[model samples]
Target: MLRLIIKKEIQSALRDTRIQFAGTFLILLMLVSVLVGRQGQKQIQKERAEAQATMYDKWVNQGAKHPHSAAHYGQFAFKPKPVLSFLDLGLDNYTGVSVFLEAHKQNEVLYSAAQEGNGMTRFGELTAALVLQVLLPLLIIFLTFNIFSREREEGTLKLIHGQGISMRKLLMGKVWGTYALVLLIFIPVICLAYFLLDQASAGFDPHVGVKFMGLLASYSLYLLIFVLLSVIISAFSKSSSFSLLSLLGLWIAACIILPKATTNLADKVYPTPSQYEFRKTIAEKVENGIDGHNPSDARLADLKKQVLDEYNVSKTEDLPVNWRGIAMQAGEEYTDQVYDHEFSKVENIFKKQNRVSEWAGFINPYLAIRNLSMAFSGTDFHHHVAFVKAAENYRRAFVKKMNKDMEVNDKPGTEDYRVDKEMWESIESFSYEAPDIGKIISVQWRSVTALVFWLVALFTLASIYAPKISRL
Candidate 1:
């Protein structure tokens, strides 16, 4: 009986010209987004990879120079593109792609894609994730908003009941049929997405397959919420037009208004310090005591005394190994401590800011899916922070190596000291591996919980409304 009802609804929907046109247009739009995203991803990957290789070459071949001078010459740390980036782009456009690593100061990632683009680019970059998250819900609303109300308006609701078909079964069948329409439209896009991803590189990441499947599952739940909500609203409405209007309003609230408002509220609640103040705070804490090599620092005088005592030397020119390098390394270590504290405070503020919307995921499946989608794609805040920290660690290690080389190879009190290009080998080739799926799930646990909450809530609503279909 359920099969018969589903077949009838499917046949009826197939006969509706509106479904055909809407489905076609949505598919075309998604395909276009995928095409544009693919080109952008390929181009971005090629450019960053080439730039990194060139930068490394320059670093190794840079003529023999004083260790400090070579440290100042610096290397660029270019972040590699994630394999799933084509699907979501996410914060990649907003976050910087490269960072400059030098001696005295740590650098923020620089040269974000948004910085290079025009003002209009801030509107949002087009990607398959945007198509599925925002626009696809619009299509689902168009398809399912009137599924029950139109039957009632046409007086077929009672007539179908008159045939002894329970309203609950009928509603379930309609829900399945409407959802099938979405699958029909989305399946081709899914297949095409897989093909494009498979063909994009010579080697495949196993994790990409896992991440892609998770993307499908998350988006399916998101679409299901829209389907169930639309049908529920239709069941409660007197007219199909009213149902459509009501669903549209709900869509705008969940998808548009709430997201923007949450961000604003989060900012107001947890304000971050200004850049100058942040830097000033770090300098105040670490400047005087850390750098024992600085001649004027009375704070370093004690450290200098201890070092000379440990080296068993009474005068400046007597101790073996460059005590200056030892002092510099100690200063670098202290500077790292100061920066780490300051950076955590800043990062915590950012966490609080995003937490506001993450909680709103319970009210808006759109937010839940947005977070999960970016997490899986490795373009979320969590992923960006991981990359940033990894780059910083590499920079610190490279600086320490240079300092040690200075201490061991160069004589004390010699301004003419220099190192061969071979010293560049102390720094390893930089590579980044994104956090695994397990780590991503931990970071986005709230979003995952919200998605699960919607599944239970929407399903419960669907069951409750299924039995109440007679009221319409």
Candidate 2:
């Protein structure tokens, strides 16, 4: 009987010209978005690779001075685009891809794609995730809003109910039919994306594969919730139009308005200090105490004296190491400590701000799904933070290595000491490996749980109340 009902619903849906048009339009949009996103990803990858190559060629081929001087010259860290980023675009379009590493200062990643144009981007970009999250739900609502009410309005519901059919079976059949329609519209695009990515890149990693599948599964569950919720609204409402308007309002609240408003509210509530203020405060603290940027700081004078005494040298110049290099390295280490302290403070503030949005998953499934999707795609705040942390780690290692080399090779004084450019070439450049998707999923476990709860809640509601349609 359920199979018969599903077949009836599918045939009825296909026979409707409006439904066919919507399905066609959505499929076409998905295809176009996939193509555009892949092309954009390729272009970005090429540009970043070229930029990193240029930096390396300039640093290695050109003659450099001392190892410490070379540290001051620094290098760039270019974030590579994840293979499946094309499917979601997630935070990629919002976050910066490149960070400049140099001596004694930490630079913020620059060049956000969001800041490139006028305020037009506030409407959001066209991507597979956007379509699946926002538009596809609306399409599902359109198809399911009248599932029971329209039959009642036509007096067919009474006839069917009188025939002794169960309302649960009827509603389940309807939901399944609508879900199939959505899959038909979405699956082709997903398959095509996989094929294109595999052909373009070496091959998709298993981790990426898991993330992609998780994305698809979460999105489908999200769509099911919308279908069931819409059906419930239709079952309870007196008319089709009212059900639609209610569902539309719910959609706007969930997908469009709430996420942005919550993020802004989180920012206001947390009130993180500006970057300038943060840096200034750290710098002032350092100056008043250790003066981490200056090796000859008064606070460090005792330490320097102890070192001199231990070496049995009357002057820093009389020691085995170059005093200037030793002082510069000491200064750098102190400043690094200060920066790390400040960086942690800033990170804590941002995490507090994001926590508000994270908790908003209960109010809005779109928020939950968006967070999960971006997390899996390696384009969330966590992923961005990982890259910054990796860069800092690389900076500290590079600086320490240079300081160790200076201690071993430097002549004490006379400003006559220098390392060959060959030594600089021998030092390894900074490289970043993106974290596995499993790690990302683990970090975003709360959002995943929220999505699952949403699905279970809706399914439970549908199962319980759907039979009440006959009462209506």
Candidate 3:
């Protein structure tokens, strides 16, 4: 009986010219977005690779210079683009792609793709994630808003109800029918995306397969939640138009208003200090004797004196090791301590920002699904932080290597010390390996759980009250 009802719903929906047109429009949009996203991804990947190669070449070809001086001339760390970032772009478009590592300072990553254009970027670019998260729900609403109310207005509900059919079966059939329609519109696009990604990245890890499949599963659940919620709204509303307006209000709150509001509220509650203020604070503390920035100060003078005495050297110059290099390395370690504290504070601020949005998942299933999708794709905040941390790690290693080289090869008070450019060529370049999809899934368990809770709550409401819908 449910199969028969579902078939009937499909046939009736197909006969509507509006449904036909909408289906065609969605397919076209998905195809266009896929092509555009793929091309952009290729271009970005090519450019970043070329930039990294050029920087490496420049450093290797640099004239002989003091190892310490070479540290001051530091190199650039270009973040590699994740293969699947083409589909969603996620925060890649908003975040910087490269960071400069130099002596005594940690530069903020530069070149945000979103900031490339004028104010128009605030509207956001077209991407698969945007379509799935923002536009697809509206399409589901359009297809399902009239599912029950239209039948009631036309006296079909009375006729059908008199046929001894339970409202539970009827609504279940309607929801399933609408879900089938959404799949028809979505499945082809997903398959096409997988094919393109496979063809483009020859060395793409198989684990990305898991991430992509999880993305599909999460999106499907999201669409199902929308379809069921719309049907319930239709069952309770007096007319089709009211069902639509109510669903639209819900969509607006979920997709547009709530995410932004929560971010703003979180910033207000746990404010992050400006970079300038943070640096100034560190500098002041260093000047006051703690000297986390420069370890060659009075606070560490005792340690230096001990080392000199142990070596039976009257001054730093008489020591066997290059004291300047040691001092520079010691200074770097101190600065690292200060940076660790500041970066932790910044991370705390971001966590607070995300917590507000995380709790919002209970009120908005779309938020839950969107976050889950990004998390699985390894394109969320966690992945971004991983990249930044990896880059910083590479920077520290490079600096320490230079310092160690200087200590071995340089004589004290001899400014004529220099290392061959070949030494720079010998150093390994930074390479990042993205975390496993399984780990990503583990980290986002809360979001998945929240979405399941939403499904359960909505299904319960529909089951208990759908029968009473006639009382309205």
Candidate 4:
């Protein structure tokens, strides 16, 4: 009987003009979004690669110059584009994609896509993930919101009741049948996009397949929760109009209103410092702590005395190594400490801001899936932070190499200590590999738990109430 009901539901839905139109529009929207996203991804990848190569060439080919000067003439570190980012852009647009690595300064990532765009960009670009996360649920609501309520309104519930079919069985059939219809509409478009993507790629990435599967699984559960909620609402609704309005209200709250509201609340709770203030704070700390460039500074004088005593020499000029290089390196280390401390406070504030939304996933599955999607796509804050850390580490090594060269080879009294391209070439280029999927999932346990809880709670609600819903 359940099977028959499911079959009837599918057959009837298939004949509906509204379902046909919505499905077609969704398919078209996804097709365009995928193609556009792929093109944009390719363009960004190419641009980053060319820019990085140019920066590398300039650094390596820079002729003989002062070692400290060379340290100041730093390189740019471009963040590698993740393969799945084309499918789900996440924070990649807002977060800058490259960082300038130089001496005594930790630069923020530069050249964000959002920075280049106009006001309309704030609304967000249409990506396949957006369609799935926002629009597809709407279609599900449209399909399932009036299921049981319409049956009651048209007096078909009396027929089903007269046939002695339990409301639980009928509800189950509608849920499964609607889910099957969704798959029918959704699968072909996704498969077509995947096929195009595989053909478009220059090389194979094994992780892409695995990550894609993870996306599929996550979206599957997410969509199921919506379908279940829609059917359960329909089953209890007094009329078709009430069912439609209720589901629309729920959709708007989950998909639109709550996301914005939660973000605003988080911002109010944990305010982040402005960029100028953050930089100003770091500069003040470094200035007060040590002046590596100024040998006349009191701290540098102390450092010089301490270094001379450690070497058992009365004067810096009498010492074997260059005092200037030692002072410069000491300043670099002091500045690094200041940057790290301030950056840590900023990072903590971001984490706390993110936490509010992550926990809000329990109330809105949209937030849960949004965070999870960003993680899997490697566009989340954690991934961006990892890239920045890698760049900073490279920058530190780079400055150290220059300082060590001057200390070892230059005369202590030399005014212009120079090193050639040979010394510059000694420092390694920056490289970053995104954290593995397992690590990403570990950081997203809150969202994962929320999704699981939503699934269980929806099923529990259906089980308890479906049997008790009035037939007429």
The lDDT values for all models are 0.82, 0.79, 0.81, 0.85
**Ten consecutive residues with minimal summed lDDT in candidate 3?**
287-296
**For residues 422-468, could you state the per-residue lDDT of candidate 3 as single tens digits?**
89987877677777877776767777887888889989998998788
- Candidate 2 per-residue C-alpha lDDT over 130-243 given as tens digits, one digit per residue, 9 for 90 to 100: 888888888888898888789988988888888888888888888787778778898999898888766765342446667777877778777777777777787878888888
Q: lDDT, candidate 3, residue 369?
A: 81
Which has the higher TM-score value, candidate number 1 or candidate number 2? 1
Best by lDDT: 4
Give the local distance difference test score of model 2: 0.79
Global lDDT for candidate 4? 0.85
lDDT agreement of model 1 with the native = 0.82
In model 3, the runs with Cα more than 4 Å from the true position are 202-206, 289-296, 413-415
Q: Please give the lDDT score at residue 114 for candidate 1.
A: 91
Off by over 4 Å in 1: 202-206, 288-299, 413-415
For every candidate, C-alpha RMSD to the true structure in Å: 2.5, 2.4, 2.1, 2.7
CA lDDT of 326 in candidate 1?
75
Candidate 4 per-residue lDDT over residues 1-472, each given as its tens digit: 8889889999999899988999899988988888888788878778887888889889999888988888888889998777778778888888898898888899999888789788777778898899999999999999988899989989998899899888888888899999888888678767966786676543423466666776777888888888998999899999889999999999999999999999999999999999999999888778775334433366788999999999999988898998878988988898898898989999999999999999999999999999988887778898889888989999999998888888877876676667787877777667777777678778888998999999999988888888899977
